[model samples]
Target: MTRRRGRHDGQSGASLHTVLTAVGANVLVAVAKGVAALVTGSAALWAETLHSIADTGNELLLFVGLRRSKKKEDLEHPFGYGQERYFWAFLAALGIFLIGGVLSIIEGVRSLLRPEPLSSPWVGIAVLVAAACFEGYSWGVARRQLRVRARELHRTLAEHLIRASDPTATTVYLEDSAALVGIALALAALVLHLLTGWAGWDGLASICIGLLLIAVAALLARRSKALLIDESAPQDVVRPIRDAIVRPDWVADVRALDVIFVGPAELLVIARVVPVPDAVEVPARDLVKRVDGLRQELLRAPAITEAAVTVEDVPR
Candidate 1:
């Protein structure tokens, strides 16, 4: 049995913390941006307001996913409701696309067709700067969590983001990154409108921010889809599990092994093993006991929530 534990087991609390922090920041930012958008009549500010609103709703969905994913196994769901997290996260991504990305693009096009003068440019600028600061703080919290986990897995930040089983953490990080960039675009557009008195620049910035959201939402959607479909664990985790199963002297060979990520920080392993020719001569009852013992030992790996082993005779 491999004794290596998964590093992510202890980070669930951190993921929840990151989600909560984002929810709080986005709520505050959304309200401020909405007021600024109404006051200044800036298309860019309006787009940003929509973006923040979508983000606030997405964060709430993530909170629901996190809570529901912790439900214990029952008669109906023998494996528990782990995939609920992925399902909700996927829905959140769709919300970003429909509510934030699509609407922003439409508003941008409408503004282009019929431009509107900005009431107070400085107010929008101040609001954008404050929003950026809040987003930066949230991004920092997510980045620190990813950094620690990536170091433990010996993977780069990009690799960890793509392969991490915990969707809440990754979603927050990506959302915050997009929010920061959107703030920059809105600020630039406001400045351009102020300098040139052309509202078209503001509309263009809104379009750009919409495109950014679309891209981020696509990436998150793909990741969540993969998780919902039961993606396999990485090779790094698979290899050690195989090594552990073959460690017992009674095992002559590991015929086959399969490991799948059933949920965040949980794995379902099924393995076929060939018993030593001499060991197979033991009574049938004893062989069953040995196989059960081996299964128990494999369960020691923190990520392996469930393991099933089948013993077979050595090849002639």
Candidate 2:
């Protein structure tokens, strides 16, 4: 149990570090892209700038969620601030959709309706390359942070990237991936504009990038929403937990169980364990010990954070 607690701390720390890196890099990238958009009037550059801004805000929210989640238990909330993590993560998703996706699409459509000749293609290209490098750095950190646990869950890189409940790392990876691809689209548009002397291609590219961002944001929103709505632990996890409580010698039967994720590494579990008919009330004390032992078994699954086992009807 102690070792499991240590691992939980490690997970939170890793999430913090990755999110901070992403936020810092995104600040620089947002400024650079914003300036490039102003100087060049490239629609794609404007789209990228907004993307960075949205990413920066999302990272802050994730960091808040990460930190607030660690708050100690209190009378008002005996279960602690675990749900704070999920709430903020949900906000982060909405931010992605509203600030990142919606704004980009609106700008893209406006640009397409009224084309503007980009003044400096080279400036846009250089900024895009720099943004890509910063995104790569952020992605590297997040990947390293989540890699070990991700493998233990038998998830591939893409699966972890998409399904990770930690918004900080997940947001950074998604934003960075979108930023890299947006750079490509921007460059393509710039080249096309230069080649054909047609300004509409730049706007068209912006629209495409915006559409792409919407798709990514939708995915993030869906996952976060699921977490917020009390999604259950995967069967791979629930089965073993059910098995653990039933294995205890004093337990006659187990009924109704509720498992919830309080934080990325924390779970708030409510289980009803029935005792054997002949088991004395005092022997039930040992069952609590055995149930505590189940913490180790639960930790093996990696997602059940804290389990609360309540013995349901002791034999009189």
Candidate 3:
């Protein structure tokens, strides 16, 4: 299957669109949550405020990664900066863990130790409901993008999100999903606080939100780490590639084939192949020329950025 390069399409790409949608949502939600947190003095609202802020910053970092990764191949970097997405994404995840998760847990412990009376609890609830709408919209955008691609691959959305070569859209999708859940947690904390004169519920909710962020951050970091370490393409790509290598009648057998992801949707292929012997009638130059042509053909697949073929000389 041919995948279009995000750089080639500019901002119209799926990953870019998903990230932009998230940034817009988070900016507005963060402002609302911050105001509500101050008005209510609720631990849960404060934790959610931090979550929205971190998400906004993370999305912006993703934008930077997308832009930088688009730089055309240079002599210094022949493979292009496609993997820049992973590096920035890794950093973003780390930020969420430290800035969002760690601070949230600290805030929760502080609130638990010195329970503070909540003022204007209704206001916090109102803001959280609105925040849910905003976050839900952003999540929808990311979900639609994944659904389209997942259908193309005949894979479930969960399966595609985990294994898809591109992490940009998946990152947004996961963050937005978490945002929606966080809103619910904040709302529940507010309601429970009003129902029972207990600040512990509010503090516990904040801690739960922090743990949630940490889990998501860890998941994102693990995926990015694998990619940064040069993870291989999924089985679907490998199978098609193996078939393509020996499809030409001239190629008798593919002795060995290897494929590695160079970018989100780009791969490098190296293979050794034996050509069908024509009783030494075919010139070595012609045979080599055909083999090279086969290598070039691999470029037709959008995921395949480069390929190298070693052709066995025809028997004398």
Candidate 4:
């Protein structure tokens, strides 16, 4: 089997950095927003507080995934624990939907019904601005990692996020991005409420933040589900392995090739190939030896973590 080099290790390290940074930032921001929400009674601030809380929890889950997925292979799970990332990320997405989206919407509706007067709107705005800075810093870190991964894969930033196999870094990137946008929405609502003396504006912003969180949650859930179900790797990954297997002169045709992502940046390859007709001249023992050698050689190739070869005869 071809052992994965340090490429995946580098990815995991980068993801750990991104998640840890987010956790720290979110914890600080969540506490500040919680205080601002209570003091100012701005519905937008309340919604933002919920958003920050959800993000803090989600980042913690992401950290767990990053750590657990890196666990070495065991007897029960010879393929390793890579799917732990997907499982925890899926739960994190659910948390975003429930805690951030649903609760924010509920708070907005209640605020609209009661129409409470704002006290110290300026305080809320100050806290929001500070939160924005923290979220911005975290967003930049995730973006930097995404850019590097995209460059390595020869893909655009958008493409990488949509089709990433490893969701650890992507989860942080999305949550932080949503947090930044939510801050802007809350900021706008606060300004409008302050100017018009209408608390409805703040309530409306809260609803909008709820919707944004739901959308983000849906996206993350979809990506994680695909990976958990054994989604095939992209064409860019499959094409090269197929080429390598078909390159040898003795291989007349490849009958079948199954290539899949058993883990992040890890692949398991199984192929059935038919030898050229002239191979009949070789003794059975030598041919078996040759086939075994080919299997061993394929295992040494880069990015091929596991491989199986079967030499099939051409049908008469």
Candidate 1 lDDT over 134-235, as tens digits, reads: 999999999999989889878899999988988888999999999999999999999988899998998999899899999999999999999999999888
**TM-score of every prediction relative to native:** 0.94, 0.85, 0.94, 0.94
- Look at candidate 1 and give me any clashing residue pairs: none
Model 2 bad stretches (over 4 Å): 1-7, 158-163, 250-253, 274-305, 310-316
Model 1 TM-score (2 dp): 0.94
Per-residue alpha-carbon lDDT of candidate 3 for residues 1-316, written as tens digits (9 for 90 to 100): 2333443363238788899989999999999999999898998999999999999999899999988888877778778788999999998899789878888898899999999989999999989999999999999999998898888767899899888777788888889888888888888888988899898989999999999999999999999999999998788779889999889888888888888877777788989887787713588788778877887788777567778899765556
Could you give me the TM-score of model 2 versus the true structure?
0.85
Cα RMSD (angstroms) for every candidate in the order listed: 2.7, 3.5, 2.7, 1.9
Using lDDT as the measure, which candidate wins? 1
lDDT of 1 at 67: 83
Error of 2 at 36 (Å): 1.7
Residue 209, candidate 4: Cα error in Å is 0.6
Instruction: Write the number of the candidate with greater TM-score, choosing between 2 and 3.
Output: 3
- Local distance difference test scores for all models: 0.89, 0.76, 0.85, 0.87
**Mind giving the per-residue lDDT tens digits that candidate 2 earns over 1-316?**
2323334677788888888999999999999999999999998888888888988998898888887888776678665666676677667767767776777778878887888778988888888888888888997887787686678667777767655666667766777788788878888988889899998887777777878878887777777777777676665446667887788677788878887765565666678777776554567577667666665555565566566676667547
Q: Tell me the spans in candidate 3 whose CA falls farther than 4 Å from its real position.
A: 1-12, 279-281, 313-316
lDDT of 1 at 229: 96
Give me the displacement of residue 92 in model 3, in angstroms: 0.9
TM-score of candidate 4 on Cα atoms, chains taken together: 0.94
Candidate 4 backbone collisions, by pair: none
